[model samples]
Target: MGYPQVSAREQIIPSRVPTDAKANALEIGPERTVIEITHVGVTAEGRAVKVTIAVAPVHYLTAGYELRSPDTRRSQTDDHASR
Candidate 1:
């Protein structure tokens, strides 16, 4: 099998996502977007690989107002797992 040809614009993955994840969410066009996986495979030693056969645009919104309520106290949720 041959590797699929990906365009320069389609190759850019956002920085907020972890490198090990098979797929990631990206914010485009002023909304939250999800990119679904078309195919995924694993090697003999248990290493995983992913392939994106197609992409479609979907619109989503976040409950930012509820998560960022002024009355609620903000706390650090990051556990310093990577850093």
Candidate 2:
């Protein structure tokens, strides 16, 4: 059996929320927080194939946030067919 190839990796970070309009300050201080994210890809045989790590501010951990690798096989096939 073969493991699926990783096509691309994407990371999304949240924007800082403004605490004061005139002072132009963020609600969450970057120095006060750390967000560590890990992405592990496993093969069908239950073996670890790849691992990814990312670090960001705590405020970036908002809802709907995700880190992942999207399959590029489908897009590759589509490109060949279009040609």
Q: Please report the candidate that would top TM-score against the real structure.
A: 2
Clashing pairs for model 2 are none
lDDT of each: 0.36, 0.53
lDDT by residue for model 1 (1-83), tens: 63443221224332232223223433244334444324444455444444454443433322232235433433333334335
Give the local distance difference test score of model 1: 0.36
| Candidate 1 ranges with C-alpha deviation above 4 Å | 1-28, 53-55, 59-83
Evaluate model 2: give its lDDT. 0.53
The regions of model 2 sitting more than 4 angstroms off are 5-31, 63-83
Lowest summed lDDT across 10 adjacent residues in model 1 is found at: 6-15
If scored against the real structure, what TM-score would every candidate get? 0.21, 0.39
Per-residue lDDT of model 2, residues 1-83, tens digit only: 56874443345443333224312333445344455556677656556678786655564465574554346767887899999
Highest lDDT model number: 2
